[model samples]
Target: MVEDGHFWTETNWVFIEVETDEGVVGVGEANWTVFRARTVVQALEDMERFAVGLNPFDVETLRQRMYNGNHFLHTPGVVQSMVIGAIEMACWDIMGKVTGQPVYNLLGGKVNDRIRSYTYMHYKWMPPEPPEKAAEAARHYVDKGFTAVKLDPVRPKEGPRNPRIDELEYAEAAVAAVREEVGNEADILIGTHGQLYTHSARRLAARLEPYDPLWFEEPVPPENFGELREVVDSTSIPVSTGERLLTVHQMAQAVENGVRIIQPNVGLTGLLEARKMAGIAQAHYAQVAPWMYAGPIAGAASVHLCAAIPNYLLQESLEGWNGFHNDILEDGLEWDNGDLIPPEKPGLGVEFDRSVLESYAGEYRPESS
Candidate 1:
């Protein structure tokens, strides 16, 4: 039961830089829980054999070998997927640098010039009151020109606290407050961190129908596709999931089961795999909204992806615009009236700052005994 805090914190992002022989460098990211950031760094170190001399343009060939070459890492999950994703990400970045074109252009150019973006606000972030501050936090982002916001007020039952009735009250009040404040001009996304029982979650979804939320995110855990399908069928609110789903097979199965929106993380699926998932989503009339908790590299990659995706709904970004990400790149990412503009610069359109990366080198991995 991962919460929004896992995506909000800045101390757990892993970055990868693949430098070309001609003095050009490309950047990528491996986004996961803080606890696994070190292991991802080590995985990247172990990948030097595969990545050292690979041609940046031969991304698919490299990805195939990376997946098939390793006997233990044939399937996609957190560890292997993050490692493969980071490698492919850097390859695309390097290609962009070599060709002098934005990654989006290489992916097939933009369907829309501006990609819509969204932000998440915990119910207790500002003003610290569960239901009362919901509207305030929503309004704060709205005032900043963001038109979409997400929050999860329901605590997972695993927490030893399962006040079902009270949880519904708090969740309802918070969403209602957000609706009242932002009105229909903005979209409200309801999150649950896959916490509630489908039967009860169905009833809760009905209760929230009045607020006209964009979707109910991960109402139940992501595993039970059959049960998740039932929940989606039972609810009027569009159901969304995919953060924990690792492979395209999982994503396609969920979408086929009727997930209205598919979220593929660049750090989890890599750009190419994520793009394939997006295409799968589009084939089913669904949309792709890349979820990110990694630093600006992931953010930049998502923006590039959104540019080329016809069914891109919106891009999720950290609310605070944490400097840990921005400080590492010269032209990280900028927001303009709730939309992201694709950069004209080539090769993922961002620079790597080795100084900031080295400062936290010790935290990247544990010392070998």
Candidate 2:
């Protein structure tokens, strides 16, 4: 794990590097938990026994062994999925390196040359900031060529429950402000972070419908698909979910219920599983917009996945992949206008700058002597 103070909080990026006997080293990221980086590192350690002797090309077997092999702890949660996902990602990287092809080619070849992206509004303009300030933030990204921007206008002070009248009013005003500023030049995405009850989510969606958001993301908590279906039924705006979902089964359930847009996190779901999820979404006419909140390695994996999936919608970018993201990668992800150009190089098409990675290395460097 590496500590980096570049984001809103002092965050730790948990990365996995798998090296084969041929001296091919492939890297992946597993920084899924909010503040439990070390816990993920320990879990990866425990699961290492399953991957030590596996062939990099047998990605499915590796996933099954790590997942089903652990009879005692095989419930399939975020931490476990993230561990298996990271290792599976590295194995793909190894496979790509061995074959002299990019990961996308191995998946199914590119269906998109460039992936469209969207980012959250600046942190300073988060809720409690007036509607005008939120409009200013929206204009900032639109001016920079982003076709879409996301914001969670309604923030529940406590736990997940129904929102207050004033909270709904502020959210409506915020979305209206952003719409007036950017006009039709950009799509406004409403993200609630699954903080509302089903009824509140419907109410919030009703308020923002006039503004015409691209989607209402995770309006209600992800645990209950029945509630999600209720929110979907209640809203005219498209309801999207799946960043918190741990496996393809959960994603299938969400799409089967009524969600037309699936936002699977490649970092947590693994590339192969995400592909499977995308297939599931495609069968039901749903779209895949790979969610990203971790470091660049996972972002790189998302790029490859997006490039290959026919039902891909949009990708989440951390302010156009600038700052430490560019610093850590040998060649930062290429961002032009509002799109990310998939790298043509082998493996993930990007490599870590060892000097920068060493500088950020924190308490959990398992391979460090």
Q: Which has the greatest TM-score? A: 2
Q: Model 1, residue 342: what's the lDDT?
A: 83
The root-mean-square deviation over C-alpha atoms between each candidate and the true structure, in angstroms, is 3.3, 2.8
Candidate 2 yields a Cα-based lDDT of 0.89
Pairs clashing within candidate 2: none
Candidate 1 lDDT, 254-355, residue by residue in tens: 999999898888778888888899889989999887887667887788889999989999888776444555666666577688888888889788776678
Off by over 4 Å in 1: 1-11, 123-128, 156-163, 320-322, 353-365
Decoy 2 TM-score against native = 0.96
In the range 92-148, model 2's lDDT, one tens digit per residue, is: 899999999999999999999989999888544788889999999899888888999
TM-scores of the models, in the given order? 0.91, 0.96
Model 1, residue 163: displacement in angstroms? Answer: 4.8
- Which regions of candidate 2 deviate over 4 angstroms? 1-6, 365-369
